[model samples]
Target: MKAVVIGGGIAGLLAARVLTESFDDVVVLERDKLSDEPEYRAGVPQGRHVHGLLVRGGEIMEGLFPGLRDELVRSGAHLMDAGEMRILNPLGWVASGRSGMPLLVVSRPLLETHIRRRVTAKIVDDAHVTGLTFRGSTVDGVLTRDGRIDADLVVDASGRSSKLPAWLAEAGIAVPEPEVVDSRTGYATRLYTAPPEIPVVVAESLSAPDTPRGGIVMRIEGDRVMVTAQGAGGDHPPRDPEGFQQFLDSLRGPIAGMLADAEPVTPVYLFARTASRRIAFEQVTGWPGGLVAIGDAVCVFNPVYGQGMTVAAMAALLFRRHSDFSAKGCRDFQRKVAKTAQGSWVLSSNADQSWAGVEKTPAPLMRAFRWYMKKWQVALVHDQDIFLRFLRVVHLVASPATLMNPVVFRRLAKYSRLDPRPGRRRAARSPR
Candidate 1:
């Protein structure tokens, strides 16, 4: 069997790697030229920004490509326990300790380079896929600039700019409109020489209404730290250095102070396409066979939550588990991929809805859930157990439902009475 995967990004590379197990031959088609070194390319504009390989994502990638974690660490990626990182949420700072969940802090380019090296598949760079080749109702191959490449299965792992919907529409397959919840979030990132005593990840969480700005200082590969200033609801960070520093200073944490004397190594790069979008291809009654879409081709989350890579990894894993090349099999796999993205979509969209300029209002149940989450955030400040659960959920290791367990529910009930004021003040430091 032959599988053709479009886009040689993290999603495409991982999908190609997984397809190698099921298909006799797997080929990846990338529009941009693949570089030997970890250099930024035009295809991935967000490659210059900060990216995190969450604990669950790290585990999945390591399982797919063995020794991946150690290799990343050797290549200058920081491997640290997630809890050791200092996190300044809207409520207060989360206690620093060992949570037993390991995180790999690496840049997009370096991580993609290492994964591309490990993928045992034929990757054809500059093979721009324009459309799909159909054998009657089933998609048999892809139409590229060079020629038609036949495949038993075609996987669309393209990023946010995927043209699968348009291609499908041309083939008479009507797809549903994608669900979107955009908070107008924007990011400004610059690489700085790491100070001697900087934390692995120092982040100030963005809350809605009052605090629309946030920032993070993450230690990545090459002895450098990436400082990203983020804003939502039209309060975007500026591209200029002076304006960026002022925005950082406006954040609730010590991010600005930590980078007071640090020397910048790169110019500030701005990324503003941070909307939560999901297309329900599985819901299409006339969905074609021998084709599947994963990663940003299906759903995209707010970058502030850092869920894109991990969710892409999860979708690839789902693809591997449901590896059947038949018509019904492709439809089933797409459905599973949609299911995988649903949780992250809800989490990201719910948070975005809390912002001021967001048009969508939360339903009654979601409003209640958000209310409970606010209380849960307060509990995270004083309760380590609750914080660990929250960490697991955020890492995609556990379901969000786990946060409503009796233990967490009782804690929320207990902390519900505490003042839920928004600011930098550490509300009720006592562990009562």
Candidate 2:
């Protein structure tokens, strides 16, 4: 059996790696020349932005590539204790502390470079995949600019601008309408020659109504720092140095001040195409077999949330679990891939949709859910237990369902608004 993967970014490399287990031959067709140097691969527009590997994502990657964490550290990746990172949210800030989950902080390119080296598959770089070669619903192989590379299965790990849908339509397959939520968000990132003493992650992401922006400064590999300024809902970050500094200064807290003295080493990189997009492949009646899509090819979240890489890892794992690419098996895997994305979709889109300029309004239930989360955020500021739960859910270590459980519900009840009106204290209600 043979498998061919399109696009050689992190998702495609991981998918190709996973296929090596079940297929006799696995080929990764990449449009960009896969360079040995630790730098951004072409076609990955967001590769220059800030990225994080969630706790669960770290575990899965390590399992797939053993000693990969140590290898990353040896190559200057910061093995961060997620619990110890500082997070400044609109409701309140989470002070640096310790937790059980570890985060591997590295640049997207460096991480991908190492993974690609370990993939052990036949990597054909500079080979652009034009479309799929179909034989009655089952993809027989791919059509590249060079020639046809036949395979039993073809996996689309291509990023957001995937042409797979068009290719599929040509092959007589129709996918469902995509769900999209645009916040008009943008980000500006610049690399600084800061020494290695920087925090593993310095993030300020909180979705209070009308708060349209945030920022972060974290250490990536190579002993340098990446400072990213975020803007949403018509508040776009500037791409020039002076304007970028002003935008950073406008952030909610002191992260901007932290970089006032750091020496910059790269030009400011701007990315404004941050939108939440998802396609329900399982909903497509008679979804084609021998073909599957993962990563940004399936769902692309706002990069500010740092959910893409983690979600891609989970999807690759899901593909491995279902192994076969037969009609029924493909359906089952697509549904599971959609299911794996539900948590991130709910978490990111709900927050992005809350922005003032974002057109889509949350449903009544979603609004109520965010209200509960706002209260929970306030609770998380003071209660370690609540904060830990928040950490787990955000890192994908635990399900969002845990937040609505009785234990958490009771805790949130204590932090409800206590009428700040003069001389009047609303009766304090106990948990039901």
Candidate 3:
């Protein structure tokens, strides 16, 4: 069978790579003129920001491209044990513990190009897929600007800006209406030089309550560190030199101090239109035969959580699990892929909802639970087990349900009483 993958981003490449293992021919059509070197383009605007390959993605990527982690490390991406990394939550500084998994930090562009180069599929750059060239209802091939190429299947990995839906409608198929959860967020990222000879320290600092700000400092391929400071709900960080530093200083922890001391490399890169969006492709009726969508094309999350590429990579794994890649397979594949994407989707949704000005308020019980969790987050500062469970959930290794278990509740109760609030001093009885 032949497979034509539209869009050569991480998702498309992953789809093509996996398809190659099962199909005779796989062609990837990328709209942008892909560079042999690592660089950003107009198509992928998120490249300018900090991107992380979560521990889950790292495992899948290595399976797809052997020695990928080592190559990434050789190219300059640092591997920091996610549990050992410094994280400042709304509560306080929680001590890092061993989760036996680490995250690979690299520039978004490098990660894409690295995966693209490794895939052996025929990549046609500077090609826009105009539409689909189908016979009756079965998709036989794609309609590119140049001409048509026959294929057994087509995968739409075109990202959140994908035109596949319009192309499908033009082909006389029902276009899927996606559900979106928009949280008007913005980000300002700048590259800085790490102080002389200091090993890169990956740090994430959160801005709580009054300020919905967060930032990440990690060493990428170059000898420089990438620092991204982001604010939600229209609280844009200024591009001016002094204001940027002030924004950093307002963060929860030592990141502001580190940035205050570190030298600047790249100018502050600011990005906006950061919203959580999910395309419910599975709900669409008679979607299409021999065609499927993956990656940000299916779901685009707020970049604040850094799950875009990882979730996309995970989607590829789901796609590969399906034995069939035909028309019925495409629809079935979407339903199956939803299960894999649901975890990260819920993870990001909950975190995004934490900020003020977020439109979608949870139910009364959930709102109360979030308030209680906030207190637990504060209590987690002195509780190692709570901290570990929180990190595990954030990393996607564990579910959000794990945190609500009775054992975790008992631990939190003990910590809350022992380390009472600044003004109050009371001990609550432990749960039986």
Give the best candidate by TM-score: 1
Could you say which candidate leads in lDDT? 1
103-147 per-residue lDDT for model 3 (tens digits): 777788888888888999999999988888877767889888899
Q: Model 2 — TM-score against the truth?
A: 0.94
TM-score of each: 0.97, 0.94, 0.91
Ranked by TM-score, the better of candidates 1 and 2 is 1
For candidate 2, write residues 1-432 as lDDT tens digits.
Answer: 898999888888888888888889999988888788887865888889888778988898999999999999999888867877777666556534568788888888889999988999999899988988877867788998888989888889988989977886776779878899988888899999775455667777636454667887888777789888888886888889999988877666667766767899999999888889998887777777798889999999988888998899888887566777887778888888889899999888887777775655567898798777678667766677888888899999999888778888888788787421111121111111
Q: Which sequence of candidate numbers ranks them by TM-score, best first?
A: 1, 2, 3
Q: C-alpha displacement of 210 in model 1, angstroms?
A: 1.5
Kindly list the per-residue Cα lDDT of model 1 for residues 1-432, writing each as its tens digit: 999999999899988988898889999999999898899998999889888777888998999999998998999988889977777777787755678998999999999999999999999998889999998778999998888999999999988999999999999889999998889999999999998778778887788877788888888888999999999899999999999888887776778888877899989999999888999988887777899999999998888888988989988887557757677888888889888888888888988988876766678998897888788778887788888888889999999988877887887788888878776543332121
Separate clash counts for every candidate = 0, 0, 1
Where does model 3 exceed 4 Å of error?
A: 197-209, 416-432
